[model samples]
Target chain A: MIAADLAPGAVLSLECPTITRTALALYAGASGDHNPVHIDIDACRAVGIDDVFAHGMLSMAYLGRLLTDSFPQQSVRSFEVRFTAITPVNASPTCHATVTDVEDGHAHLDLSVQLPDGTETLRGRAVVSLP
Target chain B: MPVDRSIIGSRTPAFSTVAERGRLRFFAQATGQTDPVYTDVAAAAEAGHPDLPVPPTFLFCLEMDNPARGSFLSDLGIDVRTILHGGQSFRYHAPAYAGETLTFWTEVADVQSKKGGALELIVRDTHVERDGAEIATLTGTIVVRDPRAGR
Candidate 1:
């Protein structure tokens, strides 16, 4: 567990489970985001997309896990993400956080989630209080 | 139809909701959160929280508690089917716990047309509060793709 003393260039990562349609369905129910394009195959076809894709929030959740895995829950001052691309069903997403600056008991991080196909699905930043 | 830039300064009526434990647990498990602090009240207290601390980005879900959530788009004559999640950001002022009634008020912060009006972006800023105290601020972007553009 990295409890501060982290340099500006410190890097932390989390390998999320291979996202599945079942997971997406559960996430929709749990998060209450029932957008059919995320879970319904027909909706995807109507939009010229072949299959349902993972929710952008799901990948953001994984990035949260990465921070919680290293720092205390309270230490997480803030987290935010941009939905860059869709994480299609069955795609494996890896979350990465690189510390860009450390100051006054906080560390600012550059965050991202990427698939193996070289697609960066989500990009974001976070601020964590240092111990 | 292009988004009305006049809607940029509009604010949604405030709405509130409680972070029920059962749903919090469900969300934790669904997101593969290994930390028990999000589900186990005792563990959370030990971690210096009065109760289960709301997970990161969970407030975005809570924002949907705005029963008029879809009304914003409808009022602007935008079809819900033409939208996509563009992006989101959050800044926490304090840790919110399960069972606390959190209030949300959102403002349409910005509106933009891109790709020669083929796509429109609506940016929203939501203030998360509890007992009139700031809990967090969630900013999200919704992209509206013009179904007929460039066709």
Candidate 2:
């Protein structure tokens, strides 16, 4: 695992690797967050959304997965994220995290969820404590 | 039927409890969180927290429908197995620490359905109060997926 030593402003991007509806549903089953906006396309269109979207937690969960899998001192101290927009499933979602600041054995990251067109679906930040 | 927007300001009944240290440790371990402050009370106090603070995600285990934690959506006629976790965002008025009695409530914030899918937004508000003073409010947004559609 790489150390959470990215200089402030360093950025990294990850593409959603076909985290299909089935995978999402399974996560919901395990996590108990069964929301139809993430599953019902019709429901999504009713809200003027282009397509069914992934759960906000699901997005953050992926980021959490990234933190645990890639960064050093994997345990997250305090995580804070905000959703600016919804991520559509029609195209692949690219997730990126930019190192914003580091202090007290923690690194703060500016994160984003975006589409193939580079349209941002969500933006947030997290403070992860290194081991 | 349309979801009532007036309920936004209403607060659900609060449930209170002190998290067992063992359980808190287990939760931190289960979520793969290894921060010493979460695992050690002394470390937490040294960091200025009154006690070991549970991970923010740890609340999901308590509020969300888990067999042991009880079901939050089953009464709504929602099948626990068919749903998908949609989104979660939090506005922290204060940081949550362990051993504090937390009074929590949930309200159905927004419910919108589309041709492709439906999204139910539920907000959970938890207040960590001590002697009537306000501590923190944890607002969570949950989305449950509809099962009848093709992914």
CA lDDT for candidate 2: 0.58
- State the weakest 10-residue window (summed lDDT) of model 1 chain A: A1-10
- Candidate 2 per-residue lDDT, tens place, B27-88, comes to 55433356677779898778777777755554554555323223445545555434544445
Assess each model's interface with DockQ, reporting 2 decimals per model. 0.68, 0.14
Instruction: Assess the local accuracy of residue A68 in candidate 1 as a C-alpha lDDT between 0 and 100.
Output: 83
Model 2 chain A is weakest, by summed lDDT over 10 consecutive residues, at A68-77
Query: What is the per-residue lDDT of model 1 for residues B7-65, given as tens digits with 9 covering 90 to 100?
Result: 88999898999999989999998999878899999998888899888888799999976
Residue A28 in model 1: lDDT: 93
Which residue window of length 10 is worst by lDDT in model 1 chain B?
B142-151
Q: Each model: TM-score of chain B?
A: 0.92, 0.72
Q: Each predicted model: what fraction of the native A–B Cα contacts (within 8 Å) does it retain?
A: 0.68, 0.11
**How well does candidate 2 match the true structure in TM-score terms?**
0.55
For candidate 2, lDDT tens digit of each residue in A1-131? 34545678787766665557765565555445556666777765665545666665656655655554455322454455666565555446777888888778777788787777877766777676666
